[model samples]
Target: MSKQTDAAKEGVQQLDAAAAKVRLAELAKALGAANAAYYQDDAPDLSDAEYDALKRENAALEARFPDLKRPDSPTEQVGAAPSAGFSKITHSQRMLSLSNAFDASDVQDFVGGIRRYLGLGDNAPLPFTAEPKIDGLSLSLRYENGTLVHAATRGDGTTGENVTSNARTISDIPTTLSGAPEILEVRGEVYMSHADFAALNARQEDAGDKTFANPRNAAAGSLRQLDPAITKSRPLRFFAYAWGEVSVPLAETQTDALARLEALGFQINDRTKTCDSGEEMLAHYARIEEERADLGYDIDGVVYKVDDLSYQRRLGMRSTTPRWAIAHKFPAELAWTSLEGIDIQVGRTGALSPVARLKPVTVGGVVVSNATLHNEDYIAGRDANGAPIRNGKDIRIGDTVQIYRAGDVIPKVADVDLSKRPATAEPYAFPTACPQCESQAIREEGDAVRRCTGGLICPAQAVEKLKHFVSRAAFDIEGLGAKQVEAFHTDGWIKEPADIFTLRERFGQGLQQLKNREGWGEKSAENLFQAIEEKREIALARLIFALGIRHVGEVAAADLARHYTSWDALAETVDKAAPAATAHRAAEEAIVAERAKAADEGRRANLSAARDAAWADTQPEAKAAWDDLIGIDGIGATVAVSLVTTFQQATERASIDRLVAMLTPTAPETRATDSPVAGMTVVFTGSLEKMTRAEAKARAESLGAKVSGSVSAKTDLLVAGPGAGSKATKAAELGIETIDEDGWLALVGDG
Candidate 1:
């Protein structure tokens, strides 16, 4: 299996604090190494898709928990530092990266967000230029007095490596330009055509030298050579679409600017078009994606930019990406491969996930060796709903399966080709017991996965839980990584989270001391101990996330922490809400049973009545407590049930208590107190003029207000705009305070 496939097994959503932290560190190290290998050494370590997936995963985690963002975060950095062999040239303007849009909705959001930020109406004439995003190295050519002065590669965005002589050697790049500004910096991509790249590789292979991986790598390697003669020998091309540090404005719009560059003897993509609406931009993007294979050069996606220079300037930029533009990336590529075997791997949650070991095959430049089987239902040609899939074709060993990979998501089997299935292959029988611990692996009703009943006794679960407890966003012991956790668990040195705190007192001076262990010494062991000691005091949110409660992810943990303020308050609330949560679960189960019986009898059942009857016996106090728990912003019944159920387990509760006793958890950061909307439940509806719904919610949350999706008695304020519908009417009927967009702006002091 590829390293990427191995890493993708642990989905980001399934990762606990520790696992996420460990994975984040791994991604950072891997991506940084890949960047250095690709940018500096011109030897790519990871495929483009794999690299993009890693970057996406890292960005997703950072977005989820901004507080846990690393100092060496790849999202903040552009490329590896300029290679030492080349002279560094600081860019007159930073060459920014465009944020990616993986789907149609993302592109819509990009356009919508810009419109919202600019306070423009939906029908406003917001023209955008859509063009293919070339998959190659970015180059900046500086021209003074219409004469080419220097050329540089976008090494780290701000500072680049000088490649002026090599740039001059490329026939497409003119040494002198006519009808150009006194000082014009033309920025574009440097690439090699597919045919040229193939020929070049053939020549290198015939000469017994290292062949390039792809056209991009070949272009990068050929251009960055110390000898310009080597670059001249290679067929390279340039496409100018942007400019930097121009003495005078090239044009009033992005379309005109590109046209100006083309007029100045630089080539721009002929497929570029000026789109007037989001729909038009997406249409152009689809066209480009459809024509990508025949484009004769590699293009990853389509770039969309606000055409108006004034609007672009007003949109400005984030830390790394411009707000006025985005790269609408192509969808996942598919390929056919033989499924050699299926292996069941248990996760931290005891989920028996089946992984397909495939005969390695390249899918859009990325080599696929493993793909997720999802569940037994998936392998049996059924979906989670027990509906037929792939025309009821079951996947078996030695079957030809179609695999697909999307942004950051693991590769999955899309379909099975029965025509190619081996005649000798038999149906796969999923294991009924935990492969590691021999415990009963039971598939619960309404769940697709078969979970092991071993709990903590299962080595897989124990070690995984322990790893989560010490993950970076959790306790974050410096030297205690996933490997160390496994080693300690195997050696019977640490079995639980609490055992970590007692390590020094129990074994520091004894013969079984960690320092005396193999591969350990005075310095390394001391550092581990110091790291553990440093985490004796931690934030409440981290502590909550470290517990590894089901459905209680980093974001949920933060919401819980912010709502409860302290550990004691959170524990007390859970204790009070447990009975109600359990009752609710009972009600749900009762409804499910009724529906099952009704289905068996070929009759309909009143599931709502069944649920009400089951929940009717709950005490009033328990019900009230449960309501309060779920009432917290971003907290729902699902998270509340998980929290309550986790605390209801005596053994687990005791373990948590023991861990808590050895440490002090700081209170969650307090929100703004003096704001008018502080402690209020605000719901936004209809056409917000000044800001988008997301912007409004974020603004409200930042000012200590709870932003709810629906209007109810609990809603204190309703910020309604034009075209306000049922929500506004409901708010008025509920007697909640109603305000227009202007009133809301005035209330928030933004007007």
Candidate 2:
């Protein structure tokens, strides 16, 4: 597994069945939301690498426990649902998503799996077609009587959004074809070349409009526009690779099919080739990856497919993916850049994060000028555990550092080039105090980050939170951007979220104070007021996110809002859950202390047992509340504790109460309600022999059960396996029924 994949599945290997179930639900929710944002909204939430890591993690868990896959598992789905702006078109043939291969071993395994499935020997002859997997929108074009009729995007595999009018505007797409199948559907990618994408972004900036983030996003946005004229104004290209629906076969093999498509006036990727062996295919992939930056277009990876059409048909499909094809994704891109300077930035939570300002350098076709330094330890050539990194050669101001971008992830300083370091360059000294407020900064034990102790008194933290309140994904007030928020706070006009609503009443009373201010006009000031008033009634998820709570981002906020549904409900739950959260923290602290004191594993286990026994003595009501809070899908103790701690603070609670009084927060989006385990709380303990812990959890959730990590009075069912210890005993003590793995299988019944 890759480092990123390991990060995604951290602690999952040792998780009890119940905990794994909770994690699986969290992954499913996150992946689903990310897909919708990327495919339907054209605004991705996760980087390509992050998405891939999560997908890989989910697949690994599913493989470990095949029976526990969720009904909404990302592995069993393609792209998200199509946008409602365009007409819907059900595909004549499903557009399957290809499985991914990240390493050489994975590719070898792919070949082995194919050969084994076909009952062939190791030396069996097998030819494969390798081509660039275009990082653009997937489109399927239908041609009747050798004439192009319609075009549709690959939406949810089975249905798509109709974009025939916009597709006709692309210069690369042929309006008519000759000597083609009587009824055919040509499938390929619609992309924007690098040059065209850059030029289009420049034009957009000149027009005072929002520019795209990358070539892939630009191409998707351009091709999916409702107005064909707008799409025509943009530069878009197409490459035909496969056939969807054909009255007659295109060719006997994949290589011949591409030739036939090109001969029939359809543009095909010139890099497509036929490889005789897996080693040859890997060599071809390496060559493509090497030339990827110079391709003038985006290509995330290389796609390999069975060469013979008969072989492809025999392999067929598996729900949403094809068994005959796989995409070997490129690794993170790396480049060396000079470290010009280091800057410390304070976030809303008062953590000091170091950012490395670098000389402009291109990596994977993107010009990167800044990279993340992570923390002080990282700068000192060490990890959080004080282990040596980069051979313990510390990063200096004048050193050349190798920076890497993982797909679209933020760039990070990976390694230092000691050969290019200047002799005069000295080791960097991280700040001892907050740069914005001059307050003492301290690094807590076991934490890699150094944080300021200034709390809300720190100007940076206060200003950042205010800015977050009106960010695009939050309240999104018009005329209120980061700059405006900073200026307003500096001028003492607004100190918190509640102050924004009182702006007109306090500043607009007498001589038009805001209107007369520099860079402000009557219309603009009134517009800002109007925007603020319009957002007085906001969605519960947006309101929760705008609070700038620690570890609660847009997705987590949405999850919380969906669980609680109303501000009152969430506030009440948090208030009631505080005591339980405190007790849980004490238990955790006890375990940590035991680990520090214990000399061996046996001693530590004994201490843990004693801690669990003490934890069982907690008040039942508080435990129930905590259980309810943590039982929400995609939610866990980290978020629950943060929410409770924030609410426990007197100042924070007062501010939140005031803000809640000033605005109305609507309910969250409704979820599916019909399932066998609906409203039931399930817990799993000890070892699961039949299925992996993660798989069992997902399978239970698919049947509508809320999986909890700890045994509580609220638990409806307790699934135990061999070696089940304290948790099983506790369940039995609480008069809850305990079942073996076989019993669980019988109850869930193959999910």
Identify the candidate with maximal TM-score. Answer: 1
Give the per-residue lDDT digits (tens) of candidate 1, residues 105-191. 667888988987888889989999999999888999999999999999988788999999999999889999998999999999999
Q: Residue 674 of candidate 2: its Cα lDDT?
A: 65
lDDT of 2 by residue, 296-322 (tens): 998878999999898887677766778
Query: Would you list the clashing residue pairs of candidate 1?
Result: 18-471
lDDT of each: 0.80, 0.78
Question: Worst 10-residue stretch by lDDT in candidate 2?
Answer: 7-16
What lDDT, from 0 to 1, does candidate 2 have? 0.78
Q: Please give the distance, in angstroms, between residue 561's alpha carbon in candidate 1 and its true position after superposition.
A: 2.4
* Per-model TM-score on C-alpha atoms: 0.69, 0.65
Output candidate 2 Cα RMSD: 9.3
Positional deviation of residue 108's Cα in model 1 after best superposition, in angstroms: 5.7
